[model samples]
Target: MPVRVVDSSAPSQVSGANPSHTSPPACTLLSVGQAFSGTQNVSSLQKDEAWRVNVRIQGCDLDHGYLCGTMEALNVPMADTPWVIQVVTFWEGEIVDMKNYTFFTGKWEATVGKPFPLMVVLSIVNRSEVDTRHWTKFPSFSPLLSQVEVDGGRSLDLSNYPYIFMRWKEQYFVNVGTDCGLTIAGFYYVCFSCSDGSINGFYYDPNSSPFQKLELKITNEGRSGFSFSSYELQ
Candidate 1:
């Protein structure tokens, strides 16, 4: 999987900001959607440049049946540059929700020490089938550990470190369990399990390096221990 960029000249539109609202007016099935702004390619720029991404979310209105918002991205200087950022909403070190705005930096900015920008417009409508009951169909997996074992038998303590998210596909990543539990660090190593082989999601911490290529799978044994392997980006 590869990192994706949101064009900044225009607004990126995503749907379903808060799906758990139970009010009749705010009742809508949540689905992940994205729209890119009209930003240009920053791959040819020098290391002294980067993009500035801004975000704002209008609180969900129970009376109105609508959720709307906007995000902005601008190319700026690297000296005081706002590098790649992950806007995460959490409480007391436990992550509630997270989103990544890479703005297409993986294509060229990955090695440039600078990242691009993205602007997003979030407009969620009451379109999906209305279900009063909150959906809990996905199985849960926990990856909030201070230490994890890589393929080399070495242990890595990721407490207080930037999160390393594994890309599962274009604009999507393997889910790192959140809201189910709380941890001392805001971030943890990427690890999880799924018997049905159905769960995949996204996570990003701006402090970490640009997105990298990785290979992830479940062994045929099904009950094997958790392990992670990192590959050199080509």
Candidate 2:
């Protein structure tokens, strides 16, 4: 048989979980030279909902040196905006490539980073803005981080500030929020503005139990002043 549907009970090689859901995930393994041309309903963990995405694998074969196929995403959870489906190709438990699709219902050309005969795991991840567990770490320091100076007024070490997991610039981790030093805060950046070469914004004060305001200003010369003010939630 050119193709066989691997059981969902097979041992998992992938790591990481949604954290909010405890239900075991369902997966399918499609090997190179597979003759599959039908659809399979794969359950996905999105917003703690049992969302099913009908995936169709067609004409799967080797193209030039990479695995190529026509993959379609159907019957996805309906939304006001299109859902972003992430296609992840894993080779021997290591991710080789990834792609995204803004899909309500659509088909896309699937290509694996490696060539044929080498079986890979094709995973369909439904990305949601509310799911922070799957959020990726930043490759570098946030742009806002560079403009601010910390206590003792020393410049922040970019090396210690990498990999702050974030979904958007609006919400992120800050390595240094106070004199406490090297503390990770779940605070977020709000109301960022740059006018006449000056920048200002508010960050949740990690030093405070409730919402406190941390004021920062960046001048044209790249010098910034930091101050703290208290406020109560309405």
Candidate 3:
């Protein structure tokens, strides 16, 4: 099936999770794409029959000298075919979350000190002739590491962050391809806001606890998808 990638143009919220209290910082959406492989063409399905999937960001802590957040997938369709979705952190080479069925969707969170790329991989197979559509969205990181100046004049590198990190819960969709095959469509959002907040504490007593009041908002303008199997950071 022919695959298409789209990026979002929303802004990132850089404050505490309270959106009603303050407006999120303006952020540019990044380009996103999906990777797939197989002999069957899956893009012939109808648009209304397509599934919608998304990942929602529940929490994040870049100020406590580490990066941590909660996430979950929503509105994924159940399939008799073998299907699985998982969160993999490249910095630690760890699978943060994994699910085999659509009913197994819920909240998952993680924290890490090392800056590296992360990703979420989904594997699905529909043996039935009937067309199926499902939508889904997941949190993702660009896997591209850049030098970021944290508070307190400390410099950190996220060059190795997972090319894809679905650490937070979001939205999504999956649908039938044009060839009467199952088409898997989804989105990936990227950001570089994970950090350890020694910078916020520099203004306070050095011996005191690090100030943990800063928030990091990461945003992208589109979505990306990937094929089943293992993916690595370059």
What are the per-residue Cα lDDT tens digits for candidate 2 across 1-234?
001111111112212211222211111122222222222222223222222211111211211111222222233332344543322111111111111101001101112232111133222122221111111112122352222211110222222221211110111112212221112222222221212111121222224222222222321222121111221111
Best by TM-score: 3
- Work out the TM-score per prediction: 0.19, 0.18, 0.20
Q: What is the C-alpha lDDT of each candidate?
A: 0.21, 0.20, 0.20
Ranking of all candidate structures by their lDDT, best first: 1, 3, 2
What TM-score would you give candidate 3 relative to the actual structure?
0.20
Candidate 3, 1-234: lDDT as tens digits = 012322212212212121122111221221112111111112223432222222222122222111222222223233443553322111101111111111111212111122122232222112111100111111231111111111200122222333222222212222322232212122111222223211100001112122212122333424333212323111
lDDT of 1 at 159: 22
Quote the lDDT for 78 in model 3.
32
Question: Worst 10-residue stretch by lDDT in candidate 1?
Answer: 127-136
Clashes of 1: 11
Counting clashing residue pairs in each candidate, in order, gives: 11, 0, 80
Error of 3 at 59 (Å): 2.2
Q: Write the per-residue lDDT of candidate 1 for residues 1-234, one digit (tens) a residue.
A: 112222112113222223332222111211111112222122322332223332222222323222222323343222244553332221111111112211121221112322221233211111111100011111221232111111110122222223222211112111222321211121111222222221122222232222211212222321211111321111
